[model samples]
Target: MKWRVESSNMKQLAAVLVCLLAACLADKPQPCTSPPLLTGAFTVSTQNEELWQYAQFIYDALGQKIRMKDLGTYDNQSFTHDVLLLFREGVMYEINDLNRTCKKLPLKADFHPLAIPKDAVLLGQVVIGSSSGPGQGLLVNTWTGDIGGTYMMTVTEFGCIPVTTVQHTNKFGWIMTSFFNNIIGITDPSKLNPPDFCPDAMTEDVTREPADFWSLFFNK
Candidate 1:
């Protein structure tokens, strides 16, 4: 009985040690010097020189991860983007230099601040996953919803109209986790507006006025 108990305890100790190691290895991402997530009424900085002012709920203290509702804006015109995102889950913190919103939908991804135009956006984020499962691999259930998601927004101006692309995937590739994928796209060219919605609120017009606004906020 004594030997059996000792063996079980040893196994538990080993498991605990392994978990701690992984937790150390895989961390969460964050941003540095970001304006505390704004709510109600907030202003943000951006490099694009189009989007200038913005706001967030600014309601409660959040965790390493923040949802769209808390840090997203799904306007009748523009797609939603993050108020901010951590490079990972806990390590590098990304500054919201873009001050952008989502792409009207989710784009499966692993990290945040998707594409910082400049390396000077030195700040980064740490992305962490669950350490509870067997160490089969990383991003296994990414496609199957076994694990949650990491989101990002990519915008391309195809002309007067802008094409917004969103691709979301698990932290680990599908080979590691389940088979789950959430990659979607949306484009608002001042043409398509849902019936009964405000027209101006929905279009992404990056004209000189808005562009200038973004420049002042981000460069400053």
Candidate 2:
């Protein structure tokens, strides 16, 4: 009888341990990297400025290459451009479609992958939409950290797909919020290639760091 009681107690303890392990796994943060190529649309807004654009981005970590094409309107001005950041070559190409020109300049920064920083602190987890029914809501994770500036990023819990990012820089005295939507994998690899006209483009003597999507419009 004592042997049976002891065995039953051991089984109960094992069941409780299993439940605790499952709970811990469920709450663990899962940081993820984005796809190598993606196309998406985003809107960035600041105090008195707003920019909307469609973006095709390529991120090659192994080769240390990054390219982005942005066609958009900024503060009522329409602009189309491509920023080819070749880290290995130490050169960046800013191709403007409006004037059909490209400016080659020095690459100021290295490639930073589109993933949650390793030191990012988990802010919270929430549901984006209605959770009453199946396929109704998106579970997302919010993370906050400093990367050149203080920023908060929200991404889907399942795929780590970006939903929004808010960045603030005290040095620049600006706070920008961006919303991303309709994100999908890149359909054509050729779209990542530098424009044909870039070979004969002029080399500019500017020594400024490359601008991000929001800064590009904000500075204009």
Candidate 3:
């Protein structure tokens, strides 16, 4: 059966759950955890830099998390897919080297998040200190709803931490290339690969297949 959430108690639930989970990190909680790429809260330096530079960065941060790697760029030149990060509770973050720091974004898997209005919510009022225009980007309170379509959200983060039910769908979908806005929250299942990541971060039961992913940057 598909998961559903209540529109009202979304934020409270998320906060309470996050707290409970954090208190019990020593005990361990289970969700989905097997990804082909690195699935953690990370900052994608998408400043139009080459994939080779990111390769070196990852190698410095995570020596063996990525055993095998194959990154595709735009037009066989310039870097297009800057970074692919995964998070827990169906959430993830990424930033392209194109827009420097303005492109920092987060990817969340809940539907309610899309329905949140910037002026309506209180918790979301935390000043982001962004350099871009004012009153931009989307932040919806996800968790309560009948998910019939595919969704991807990107939230900027200073560190990598797993959240309840969020993961980075970096190299698992065409959203990386065929994107409308910055986030990939809505799409067809046929076009997305399962939530997968790397660094061998697994919680058992959660598995992945590379065949599930599609490379829009490719013509195949």
Candidate 4:
């Protein structure tokens, strides 16, 4: 009986030691706070002088992923771009960048600015030798979605937009996260005014002016 009791106590001691060892191993040191997440109004701009444009973007912080709304205007345009993108959502509307004439389009695409394309090639971390900003980062190159051309982006935990970027094509110009301002939400562009063109259907002005048949007849 004495021997059996000793064995039981030894087994209990062994179990306790195992648990303590596991706890010590799992309790690794961690950073004090999580990395900063973009939540509010921010400005995005391009580095190329001739391709300069300003975009005012607002972020909705109430969801798992912050929702984004972008309002863009060109350098010399009197009015904002007719099209404003709501991230993965379709075209909210198309307005004439020059005259403010507006139309709507059914064009929808699954374009998340932070989404990693299926074919994206992870090219390792950013190095000081590269023209990218300081600090090591995850470098990824992709040729999908609205990128319109191949793009290389350096992602960091600090912000959704690339810390550094290079777009091989001008279709979607390079964007830099310039400013941050906390805001509740962004107003929907569609709600601002009634569409000038077709509100219910997307339209394209394919009409051509009447050809000069008289001139052709005289020349031929």
Q: Write the per-residue lDDT of candidate 3 for residues 13-112, one digit (tens) a residue.
A: 9899999988888433222112222222222222233222122112111211111123444434644343332323332223333344212223322222
lDDT, candidate 4, at 209: 21
Best by lDDT: 2
Per-residue alpha-carbon lDDT of candidate 4 for residues 156-202, written as tens digits (9 for 90 to 100): 32323334445543432564543334333344533334345536564
User: Pick by TM-score: which candidate is best?
Assistant: 2
Error of 2 at 219 (Å): 6.4
> Model 4, residue 186: displacement in angstroms?
6.6
For model 1, the run of ten residues with the poorest summed lDDT: 156-165
lDDT for model 4 comes to: 0.41
After best superposition, candidate 3 residue 42: deviation in angstroms?
18
- Candidate order by lDDT, decreasing, is 2, 4, 3, 1
The order by descending TM-score is: 2, 4, 1, 3
Reference-based lDDT, residue 147, model 3: 28
Where does candidate 3 stray beyond 4 Å? 1-77, 96-99, 102-220
* Candidate 2 lDDT, 54-153, residue by residue in tens: 6656656556676677677666888776787777877878877677777777765656667888889999999988889999998999999998788888
Name the regions of candidate 1 deviating beyond 4 angstroms: 28-188, 191-220
Looking at candidate 3, what is the lDDT of residue 10? Answer: 78
State every prediction's TM-score relative to the real structure. Answer: 0.19, 0.75, 0.19, 0.39
